[model samples]
Target: MPLASQPAGRRERNKQQKLDRITAAARELFAERGVDEVTTQEIADKADIGAGTLFLYAKTKGELLLLVQNSTYADALAQGKSEAASLADLLDAVMAILRPVVECNRKQIDNGRTYLREIIFGDPEEPHHRDAIGMTVQTEKAIAEVLQRDERVSADDAATLAHIVSAIMFVSMAATINIAKPVDEIVAEIKDQVRVLLPK
Candidate 1:
């Protein structure tokens, strides 16, 4: 068989299993002790992997957060969209899709206070960062779909609205949650913005 035609299926499966173990370990440690307090060697020990091997997967401690939280962010997006479906009004729909993801980010907000932006928008070439960007695109697509349900909005307009909504969600969350301000008030303000931004 050619190199490309080889059944590296078992090898690929093993690789994914190792990655799962590492991510699981990272998640547990980060949650228990917080990200800043946990070390890579501790993670590797928990995963039963070598320290060097752990480094191969995540180059830095920050990347480890990305690796662990990537699936969580994706899950929050999925859950948010599902919750958004029952909401008829555009403001409710938009906020439904945003709240879970916002709460998830808030968990790490303490340690993430400094590099939250970098964590959200990571280097595209890296694995965890690429996953982060992919989830973001998924989120934007969900928002566009929500907007599309209303016949009043054109597809182009809905897409444009989704883009604006995405930025607003990020900025609002960052600004409001950064200073330990009220998320509820921020969400209310965002609701007003969406009301005016979208057409009836």
Candidate 2:
């Protein structure tokens, strides 16, 4: 068989190895120092990659955060969807979907705030910003799928509902944290506000 016909395991492994090196270096540095304090050159040196190469993975420190949080966010979304699958009600499904988001944000609330600010208000010209936008859209699509499972919600309506629900959850979580409100109160208040937006 030709080399072209072979499985791409080697290629994939190499890519994974590089990514692992970068992520491992980032984890150690970010943990020991913190995001704001860690310089890109330091991370690049630790990863054994050139400074220019590091930018290929993440253009800015905030984007580097997006890179680090990528796996965690994906895992949270996966778990949220899985749990939401067990519940039939729209509200329950929505809450299940967002609960993980809240928990993930709480992991490093300072980073969370910066992450939100950068992604939410970032320039669209940046690649990482585009990725963040894409992630949000995908999350909303997942929510729409759940809501659409209900007979009462038309396919078209589901998209709108998902947008509303996602925005509500996003804003709610940010507010709850910033105001020093009891974190425990977020879920209940979100449920109330969502119920208000979507009358049952």
Candidate 3:
């Protein structure tokens, strides 16, 4: 049988499958080798595809890293939304959101720390800033709605209060810790901070 005998649709599907394989290989290499060290040719060899073909899917190694990071964050956010309800539920939900991002980015977060920091600091030309702001806005809106509906919270300052509290939680968790503490202890302190933001 001739190699060209394959149907056009099959060829396209096979090409897409190879691209998927390349993407997966790239992600693993990035995770292991760090974003700075991994090369497109290395990813291609790992995927058992030609280096030229890898370029068809990604222009550069940076794009592949971004793709992996974005997909990881999206999955985590979707899972967090599914598992959490109301402001009270967000403590764990926020943790859940961090979980996958942290897991997928273990090398970057643990060894580099720059990757996670970039998301927070953001680049003007990059979408990270907009994405972070949108995520925060959505979470704030949810918190604000919850506060407005709660008898213990004042409706007048619901949105403001929500944003303030949410910012505090995110900052506090991401902040540099002089002394490492248990997760529960940290959450307890954060919960106290949340209480401070709420009406007495």
Best by lDDT: 1
lDDT scores of the candidates, listed in order: 0.80, 0.77, 0.60
How well does each candidate superpose onto the true structure, as a TM-score? 0.84, 0.83, 0.56
For model 1, how does the per-residue alpha-carbon lDDT over 1-200 read when each residue is reduced to its tens digit?
69998776987888888899999998899888888899999999999999999988999887888887778787889899999999998778888998887777766664443235655666778888787777778888898898988898888988899889877767776774445755576566667777788776
Lowest-scoring 10 consecutive residues by lDDT in candidate 2? 175-184
In model 2, what is the error at residue 23, expressed in angstroms?
A: 2.2
Which has the higher lDDT value, candidate number 1 or candidate number 2?
Answer: 1
Worst 10 residues of 3 by lDDT: 105-114
The order by descending lDDT is 1, 2, 3
Error of 1 at 166 (Å): 1.2
Which has the greatest TM-score?
A: 1
- Cα deviation at 115, candidate 2, in Å, is 1.6
Candidate numbers, best TM-score first, in rank order: 1, 2, 3
lDDT for each residue of candidate 2 in 1-200, tens digit (9 for 90 to 100): 99999877987887778778888888678767778889999999999998898887778788777777666777878888999999988888888887787677656656666667777887777776777777788788888888888778888888898898878767876764544544456667777877765536
Residue 77's lDDT in candidate 2: 85
Off by over 4 Å in 2: 1-5, 9-15, 31-33, 176-183
